[model samples]
Target: MNISYKFFSSHVCRICHRSINWEPKSPVSIASASRLYSGSPSPKNSKSEDNRSKEKWWSISNEWKIITTIGIGIASWFVNAKQDRIHSRKQMKMNLVSSQLKELYGPLYGNRIVAETSYRAAMKEYGGLRNYLEQARKERDAEMIKRWRSYVWTVLYPLDEEAVDIICKHAHLIAEKDFPEEFDTFLKHIARMRFVMEQWKNEKGNLESTKEFTEDDFLEDTNSSGIGGSKSMINHLQLKCKHLRKQQQEYVEDISVDNLTLGMLNKIKI
Candidate 1:
């Protein structure tokens, strides 16, 4: 049972004027003495080193956390901005579709219906004149001459002009794809009607100027003059009005205002 003592003393060397370490002789074994004097760390120093290492690790972790947080924040901002833009564009498309529906149903469709009604009424009046003319011709009634002249001047001329103008003005609104067959037919008929009305207007002016406005000139079956017989012109107009009215009615019944929603527009694959 050898006892070990740690000799703790500081001595000065007179020759070198430096502090010297002195170890007193102990009964401890040489290995134990050597172990004590060796450069093994104390508990305090080890604890301090460990604390510094932990602090450095924590600093690096905090820097990474801050960088990750900034990255996430920027990414989130970009995602939200992209979502906002997409939503805005979708809303704009919806609004545009809604406006087109209103125009198609309310103004364009409504005006065309009105014009058709006017045309139908005018045709009916002309049909009455045709009946009157036929009966007068059969009966050799001279009263029809006065009535026919008055009818052509007052009712027929103005009505024809109005119908021609309405058809021509609103013809462009008819989407070719929407009513392909009817649209093409309508354009052709409108061209004919416009031509007929223009010729009648010009001829009437010339007739009035020359004092040659007579029933024989109007009722003649001749294509040389601008008026290719008034009866033929009136019959053609009546047929066109009937056909157009039927087409419009069919179109109105087929298409629905509800069908013009955003869902339907989305289906267009734009």
Candidate 2:
């Protein structure tokens, strides 16, 4: 009897075969095995890792914090300095305006008082002269007429030129919005005062030149003549002046550095 036997072998891919053939390696020693399995480091390695983590980064952060604080302080200082400069400039402008106002005030109040007093005295002297002229005419005394005419010329005092000049020189400094009507009224009265003085001077010259004076000759310029008319004008002017003075004083007193700046800025805006 003859018997036949057969042998078979299994086959796999190269990469898969290699993977299946590979065996997991065991740690070299018990200590290494303990470290690998426990997921812990040796004492020496742990200390080294701790040292690496403790690098100078924390000190760098502290330095950066200090630098950031200094930068903020410097920026704040610059801002404050700019504000101070602006404030100083504003203060300087205010002082200049205030000085100009002071100069104007001195002459305005002082000279106005003098002009008012002089006008009142002139009015009184004019009445006296009119009475004396009537007496001289009735008695036919030429000497008495001459005396009264001289007294009339001597008694009338002209308004101060310096005061008018001061007002004109500094009128632009005043804000037009502040008491505009009163300001205009004052200026008109001042002009009228000058006109009245000119008229009186002309009349006085005529009285001096004529060899023989008569009532008709004295009242020749009927339209613009008469000391009585001048007195009425002066009285009206006095009322306007009194109101103007009160307004001006109040306006000047209310002025302050802040308000002045605001007013100027408002004008610029317009």
Candidate 3:
């Protein structure tokens, strides 16, 4: 008896609606088919594999983490140190300005006020300083001369001397970068008055011998172009004080801001 067989490469099942291969397969063909199916990965499997690859790529070693941490710490320390130096320098500047205002300009300004008040009073009583001295010299009235000498010795000389002493001691604190021209005139005025006073004392209140000493030389020049002008030393000092106070306030605000920033940084570090 002879048998005949018909073979189909693939056929669809009626009930399950699945395709089945009816061809015979060798081991090599079966393995190749299996590999082909696995190589074309599904969406779910691709995503999971990608996640694992990303985890490995982004992983940090322990040694690298420690090194990075130390680098950040050093950078933070340097920044804080620089800020501290800037703050300290500003504080020192503020202190110097305070000293200038308190030790030098403050006392000088006060003395000037008192001296001006006393001078106005003297002028009211004796019809101005230069005029009174000239009248006293011309008239040579013993009582008038004595009173004038007493006023000069008691009030004017002492005030001038005190001003000179203040300048001598605290000249470093003067706001001007250069020595003031007004200061030279003031010193000269004091020196001339001192010489005249000495001569008057030696001569026993005699006005005849000291005739060479003129009013311009022996008296204080109230109008020496800059003394009582709009741009006087007192005005300069007042302006300087105002500027310094503003600067000091700015320094304080900056320091406060720096402190606040440092505090926030410390919190972040913690």
The number of the candidate with the highest TM-score is 3
Model 1: per-residue Cα lDDT over 1-98, one tens digit each: 12322222212234234325445566455555675699666556789999999999999999999898778767656655665565555555454444
In model 2, which runs have C-alpha deviations exceeding 4 angstroms?
1-57, 117-159, 202-270
Residue 110 of model 1 has an lDDT of 42
The estimated TM-scores of all candidates read 0.40, 0.44, 0.62
Better of 1 and 3 by TM-score: 3
Arranged by TM-score, best first: 3, 2, 1
The better candidate by lDDT, 1 or 2, is 2
Q: Which ten residues in a row have the lowest lDDT in candidate 2?
A: 1-10
Model 1 alpha-carbon drift over 4 Å, by segment: 1-50, 98-106, 120-181, 202-270
Q: How far is 4's C-alpha from truth in model 2 (Å)?
A: 59
Model 1 clashing residue pairs (backbone): none
Scored against the true structure, residue 141 in model 2 reaches a CA lDDT of 66
What lDDT tens digits, residue by residue, belong to model 2 across residues 1-270?
Answer: 122222222223556788989865754567777888999888789998887777667778888998987787676566556655665665555554554446654455556666656655644754644564565567766666555444434532334455557668877654334634544555565455445435433455554433465563333231122323334434543554455456555545444543655444444310
Identify the superior model by lDDT, candidate 1 or candidate 3: 3
- How accurate locally, in lDDT, is each candidate? 0.48, 0.53, 0.65
